[model samples]
Every structure is written in C-alpha cells, then in structure tokens.
Target: MIETKDKKWSMFGHILMIILSILSLAPFVLLLVSSFTDEATALKNGYSFFPEKLSLEAYRYIAEQWELIGNGYLVSIIVTVVGTLAGVMISAMLAYTLSKHDLPGRSVLMLLLTFTLLFNGGLTSTYIVYTQIFNIKDTIFGLLLPNLLMNAYFVVMLKNYFEHTIPSALLESARIDGATEFQLFYRISIPLSVPMLVTVGMTVALNYWNDWMNGMYYLSANSNIQSIQTILNNINENIRFLQQNNVGTAMTTADLPSATVRMAVAFVGILPMLVFFPVFQKWFVKGATAGAVKE
Candidate 1:
C-alpha cells in the first residue's frame, strides 16, 4: 500500500513539473513566433502562439544594423566573461575568509557584508562615484566594475556552504600534510565547491549580459563599450523617436516593424543565455540545491 501511494505521488509530481515547464516556456515560444509574424497581422491580431501569417521583415531590419549589433555582442561577451570570473573569484575568496572561525574581525566583516545586502548608495551617488571618482566613463570597466561585481548575497551563500558543507576534519588533515593556506584553498576548497561556484558564476554572467543601466549611465551614444542590451535599448528608443516625430526617411513610420523588431532584438539578446543555460544545467541544479535538507 505504501509503495502504491509513493508511486502515485511520484507520477503526480512529474505531471506537475511538466505543466510548470510548459507555463514557463509558453511566453518565450509566443515571443519567438511573434518575431517572425507579419507586422500588420500582428498589430491587428495581437501575438499568438500560432500566427496567421509569418514574415522576415523584423529580422531583415535587424540585419541592416548588423555592424552595431556585432560590436555590441563582442562587448557583452567580454564583459560577461570577465565580470563573472572576477566577481565569482572575489566573492568566493571573501566567503572562504569569513568561513574561518578564528579569523580576526570576522564578525565585523560579516556584519558589513550583510548590511550591504540591505542597503546601497542610491543611483545618483553610485553614478557620481563611478563617473567622477573612478572615472570609468565610456570605458569597458564601466560595465564590469559597478553594482554587478562581488554581490554580498553570493558571498553569504558561499560562506554558508564553506562553513557547513565542507568537512572541517578534511581541512585539518590537509594542513597536517603541510599544505599552505593558498594550496588548501586552490587544491581542496575550490575543487569541492565547484557546484556553488558555477551557480554564482552563471548568475553573475546573466546579470552582466542583461545589464544596460551601467551603459546608459556611464557610456555615451558613440561609446565603443556598449553591450547588446544597451545597444538594443538604444535601437528601440530610436525607433520610438522616429515613430513619434515621423522622421524623414524613404519609408514611412507605418512601415517600421516596431513591435516585431522589439521581439526580434530581445530574442537575439537572450539567445546566448538560452544556449548557455542548458549546457551547464547540471551544475546549476546541483549548486542551486546544494544546501537543501534531504530528509
């Protein structure tokens, strides 16, 4: 009887997960469908999973701006890679340091780290500090150095993992074997913490890839450091401006596939993440569930 009940519950859980997965994926499917939809038909009929008519006009429009978009991709790739690695390393190192119970001022440092999670210098001040103090304006560092780097939440999570999950006796054994602190960190702690580290790195990479606020604040229109999101935002804004003013062009405002273009550009921007997430899904799942109670 217990075995039958367990089987029933397991079947129900699988069905529920399938439903949730479909719900999550539905919007993205609609967006992809709509991007290929005829502009007039979409405007008239609204977006649908199965559109009455399909067109490549939106993609063609994007293709015309390929040079700018290509540059944006390059910048975004560089920022995401560099920022994720640096941010994860910095956060992990800080977390490991705080995990040491005997470290001096550990409590104070942990307190400060927690405080940052609750509060931040407002946007205006952050802008001023980065632009005026750090002078990262219009530079690649503008995308890399600001709010996305070294998240306090990641630090706390890693600290908890290092303290509770890692066996203290193992560290003692390593120390007795004459392993230096750096060796212990690199050779033991890092290898054991791969799941959590990958999780943190992926999250940071997503943030860096999707961020446009830093670009909007610190980068100029002509800045070479613009990421895909920033450039796409600029494109959308320009489209809106043209629509509002009916700017002089061979084609009328009515001819612009504004709505479909947005869908196209958004899909383009997120395409890398879509491709990336599934590849590291195992590690991501492991890290995400690392500290959960099993029983």
Candidate 2:
C-alpha cells in the first residue's frame, strides 16, 4: 500500500515540476520569437510564441554594424575570461586564509569583509576612488577592476565551504610531512575544491558578461573599450531616442527595425552565457546543494 502511494505522489510531483518548468521558460520563448518577428508585426502584436510574420531585418541590422558588435564581443570575452580566472584565484586564496581558525585577527578581518556587504560609500565616492585614485577611467582595466571583480559574498560562501567541507586532519598530516602552506593550498586544497571553484567561477563569469554599468561609467570617453553589454545598451538607447523623437530628424523611424533589433541584440548578448551554463550545470548544481548542508 505504501509503495503504491509513493508512486502516485512521485507521478504528481513530476507533472507539477514539468508545468512549472514550462511556465519559467515561456518568457524567454516569447522573447526569441519576438526577435524573429518583423518590426511591424512586433509593433502590431506585443510579443508571442508564434508570430504571424517572420523577418531577418533585425539580424540584417546586426550584420551591417558587425564591426562595432564584433569589437564588443571581443572586449566582453576578454574581460569575462580574464576577470573570472583572476577573481576566482584571488577569491579562493582569500577564502582559504579566512577559513583558518587559528589565524590572528580572523574575526576582525571577517567583520570588515561582512561590513562592506551591509554598507558602502555611495556612487560619487566610489566613482571618485576608481577614477581619480585608481585612474581606471577610459581604460580597459576600468571594466575588469570594478565592484564585480572580487565580492564579499563570494568570499564568505567559499570560506564556509573550505572550512566545513575540507577535513582539518588532512592539513595536519600534510604539515607533518613538511609540506609548506603554499604547497598544501596549491596541491591539496585547490584540487579538492573543484566543485566550489566551478560554482564560483560560473557566478563570476555571469557577472562580468552581463556587466554594462562599469563600462558605461568608466569608459564613457573610450567606446573602443566598451563590452558587448555596453555597446548593445548604447544601441538600444539610440534606437529608443530616435523612435521617440523621430520628428524633423534626418533618420526616419521606418528605416530602423526598432523593436526586433533590440531583442535580437539581447539574444546575441546572452548567447554565450546560455551555452556556458549548460556546460557547467552539473557541477554548479552539485556545489550549490552540497554547500548548503552540514555533514
């Protein structure tokens, strides 16, 4: 009787989960369809999974401006790869140090780290610091060195993971064998923390890939260094401004695929992350779940 009851509940759970999954994916499906729909058709119909008219005008616009978009892609890819690798390495090193209980001033150091999450100097001060002090403005380093590079939250999560998940006895044994702290960290701790590394790396990659604010603020005068997000953002803003103030302008609203072009650009912007997530999905999911529960 219990076996039969369990099977019935399991079937119901599967059905519910499938329904929820479809609901979650519906918006993206509509966005993709709208991107393919003709500008006129998209204006006529807001957004739909199945559009009456299909067009390549949006993509054609992208093709015409491929030089700018291509440069954006190159910049974004470089920043994401470099930032993720550097951020993960730096964050892991910091996390490992904080995870050590015997370290002097550990509590005070953690307090300072946690304090940043609760409060921060406002935008004016932050911009001043980065621009005036660091001299990052109008440079590629502006995009890579901003607030997203190393996060306090990542440090805390990873610190907790290292402390609880990694056995203390193993470190003691390695120390007894005359292995240095650096050796233990590089050889043992790093190798053993693959799951957490992948999880954190993916998070960092997503942040860098989706970031436009950093590029917008710091590289305002340097369009050459703008990432895909910043470039696409500028394109969208220009499109909207032209659409709204089409009167007496040299460029006509009808000349642009206003609606579909933005959507297509967004689709292209997120395409890399869509591909990236699936490749690390298994490791990402495992690390997230494992880090939540204590042994």
Candidate 3:
C-alpha cells in the first residue's frame, strides 16, 4: 500500500514538472516566433504563438552588420573560454587550500573572502579603480576582469565539495608515498574534482557569454571590442528607435530584416550555451549534489 502511494505521488510530481517546463519555455518560443514575423505584423498583433508573416529581412540586416556583430562574437568567445579556464583553476586551487584544516590563515582567508559576498564597493569606486588605477577601460581586459575572475560563491561551493567529497585518507596516503603537495593536488584532487570544476567553469562561462553591461559601461563602439550580447543589444535598440521615429529615409522596409534578423541573432547567440549544456549537464548535476550528503 505504501509503495503504491509513493508511485502515485511520483507520477503527480512528474506531471507538475512537465507543466512547469512548458510554462518556462513558452516565452522563448514566442520570442523566436516574433523574431521571424514582419515587424509591422508583430507590432500590430503584439506577438502571437506563431509567426504572422515569414520574413528574412531581419537576418539579412544582421548579416550586413556583420563587421560589428561578428567582432562581438569573437570577443565574447575569447573572453568566455579564457575566463572559464582561468577562473575554474584559480577557484579550485583556492578552495582546495582552504579545505585543508592544517593550513594556517585558512579561516582568516575564508572569512575575508566571504565578507566580499555580503558587501562591495559601489560601481563608482569600482569604475574609478579599474579605469584610473588598473587602466582597463576600453580594453579586452575590461570585459573579462571585473566579473569573470574568482567569485565568492564558486569558491564556497568548491570548498564545500573538497571538504565533504574528497577523502582525507587519500591525501594522507599520497603524502606517505612521497607525493608533494602540488602533485597530490594536480594528480589526485583535480581528477576527483572534475565534476565540480566543470560545473563552476560552465557557470562562469555562461556569465561571461551573456554579459554586455561591462562593455556598455567601459567601452565605446570605436573601441572595436564589442561583445556578442552588446552588439545584439545595440542593434535592437537602434532599429526600435529608428522605427519609432519614422527615420526610414536611409532604410527601406524591404531592405531591413528587422524581425527575422532579430530571431536569427537570438538563435545564434544562444546556440553555444545550448550546445554546451548537454555536454556538461552530467558533470553539473554531479557537482551540484556532491556535498549534499555527508559521508
């Protein structure tokens, strides 16, 4: 009787989850449909579940703007790759060190790191330091440095994984076998921590990929350092503003792929994350649950 009741509850939960998933996916599906619809039709109809009129003008306009858009893709890709790798390595190393109970100053360092999560210098101060002190404004470093580096949350997550999942017995045995601290970390701890590392790396990579505020704040179009999201945002804003103001003197209705291009751009922008999720999902789930149950 108890087993039958549990099965019923499980079925109920699965149905609820499927409903929630559809609700979540509805907006993205609508956005895609709207992107392909004619701008006039979309504006008049206020977006439907399906495209009102299939159009390719938006995509063609995007292609013509490739110099900017393509450059943005390149910049974002470089930043995401470099930032994910560097951030994961640095975070893992720091977390591993902090996980060691014998390390002097570990508690102090951990407390200091956690403190930043609760409070931060305001944007004005951060901007001044980066621009005047570090002189990273309008540079590629500006995009990658501010938010892509080591983060408090990732550090804590990694530390938790190390403390709970990695066995102290293994480390001690390796030490007795004449393994150096660096060797133990590199060979043993690193291999064991792959799931957490990949999870943290993917999190950092997604953040870097989706970021555009840093570019807007620290860079100008003339800087030639536009990221993919920034470029897409700029295009969307410009088209909307021009259409609103009836500034169609330079651009013919037929020439612009306003809606279709927007959809195509979105599809392109999201493709990397989509491709990456399936590849990393197993690691992501494992890492997320690694420290949940203490041994």
Candidate 4:
C-alpha cells in the first residue's frame, strides 16, 4: 500500500514539474513568435504563439541598426570577460583567506563584507565617489568597474566550499611539504574548485552582460563606449518617446516595429548566454551541492 502511494505521489510531482516547465518557457515562445510576426498582424491580432503572417522585418530593422548594436556587443563582451575573470580570481582568493581559521581579524573582515549586503552608499554618493575619486567616466573602465567586480555572497559560498568540501589534512600536508600559500591556492584549491568557479562565473558573467546602469551613468556622454544593454535601452526609450510625443510628424507609430523589434533585440542580447549555458549546465548542477558533506 505504501509503495503504491509513493509511486502515485512521484507521478504527481513529475506532472507538476512539467507544468511549471511549460509556464517558464511560455514567455520565450511568445517572444520568438512575436519577433518574427510583422508589424501589422501583431498590432491587429495581438501577440500569439502562432501568428497568421510571419515576417523578418523586426530582424531587418535590428540589422540596419547594427552599427550601434555591433559596437555595444563588443564592449559588453569585453567587460563580461574581463570582469568575470577578475571577479572569480579575487573572490576565490579572498574566500580562501577567510576560510583559514588561524587568520587574524577574519571574523571582522567577514562582518564588514556581510555589512555591504545590508547597507551601501546611496546612488548619488556612489556616483560622486566614482566620478570624483575614481574618475572612471567615459572610459572602458567605466563599463567594467561598477557592481560587477566582487560579490559578498559568492565569497561566503566559496569559503564554505573550501572549509567543508576540502579535507584539512590535504591542505596541511601541502603546507608541510613547503608549498607556498599562493602555490596551494593556484595549484590545489583552484583545480578542485572548478565546479564552484564555473557556477559562480556564470552568475558573474550574466551580471556583467546584463548591466547597463554603469554605462548610462558613467558613459553617459560617450555613446560609443556604451554596452549592448545600455544601447538597447536607449533605442527602446527613443522609439517609445518619439511615438508617444509625436516628435516626427511623418513617422507613423504603426510603421515602426517598436514592440516586435524589442523581442528581436532581446533575443540577440541573450543569444550568447543561451549558447554557453549548455556547456556550463553540468558544472552548475554539481556546484550547487559543492558545500554538502558526503559521508
């Protein structure tokens, strides 16, 4: 009787998960279809999974704006790569230090790092500090510096992985054999922490890729230096404002693929992540359980 009940519940859980999966994927399906549907059909019939007429007008419009979009892509890619690499290395190194029980002021440092999660300087102050002190404005550093460099939660997760997942004896043995702290960190901890690193790397990469605020704030004057997200946001805003305010008398709202074109732009923005996810999916699954102690 218990076995039969368990089997029924398992089947129920599977059905529930399948339903959830469909719900999650439904938006992307709509987006994909809407992007391909021409301006007229979408406006009259509304967004649908299957549009009566298919058109590549939205994509063509995006391609025409490729000059801006292309540069934006290059800038975003550079920032994401440089920031992710730097963030991961710094995070791992800091976590390793904090994980060492013998390290002095470790608790205090951890407390400070945790404090950042709860509190931060207001936007105006941050902007002043970056602009006045750091002076990163209108440069490539402006795109790479803000918010993406380090994460406190990532440090804690990595610290836990180091302490709990790795055997202390192995570390002690390495130290006893005269391996420098840097050597152990580079050769031992890093190699063993690939799963966690890749997982954290993905999160870091997404943060950098999707970021536009830094571009908006610091690169405000330099449109050429703006990231893809920043450029897309500008394009969306420009289109909406012109349509609403009737800035151009001859420019008809119905003529532009404002709604459908957004979907095309979004698809292009997220395309890189989609391509790389399958490669990192396995590592992400493993790393989520990185801190669990196996008996």
TM-scores, in order shown?
0.94, 0.92, 0.87, 0.90
Tens digits of per-residue lDDT for model 3 on 173-272? 8999999999988988887887888878888999999988899888977779889998888888777776567676677654455666667778768878
| C-alpha RMSD between model 3 and the true structure | 3.2
Q: How many clashing pairs in candidate 1?
A: 0
Give Cα-based local distance difference scores for all models.
Answer: 0.89, 0.86, 0.82, 0.85
Per-candidate total of colliding backbone pairs: 0, 0, 5, 0
Give the per-residue lDDT digits (tens) of candidate 1, residues 41-134. 9999999998999999999999999999999999999999989988999998999999999999999998999899899888898889888999
Q: Candidate 1, residue 243: CA error in Å?
A: 1.3
Better of 2 and 4 by lDDT: 2
Clashing pairs in 1: none
- Among all candidates shown, the one with the greatest lDDT: 1
Error of 2 at 211 (Å): 0.4
Deviation in angstroms for 105 in model 3? 1.6
**Model 2 over residues 195-265: C-alpha lDDT tens digits?**
88998888899999999999888987446989999988888887888889885455588868898998898
Estimate candidate 2's alpha-carbon lDDT, on a 0 to 1 scale: 0.86
Candidate 1, residue 20: CA error in Å?
A: 1.0
CA deviation > 4 Å runs, candidate 2: 148-150, 247-251, 283-295
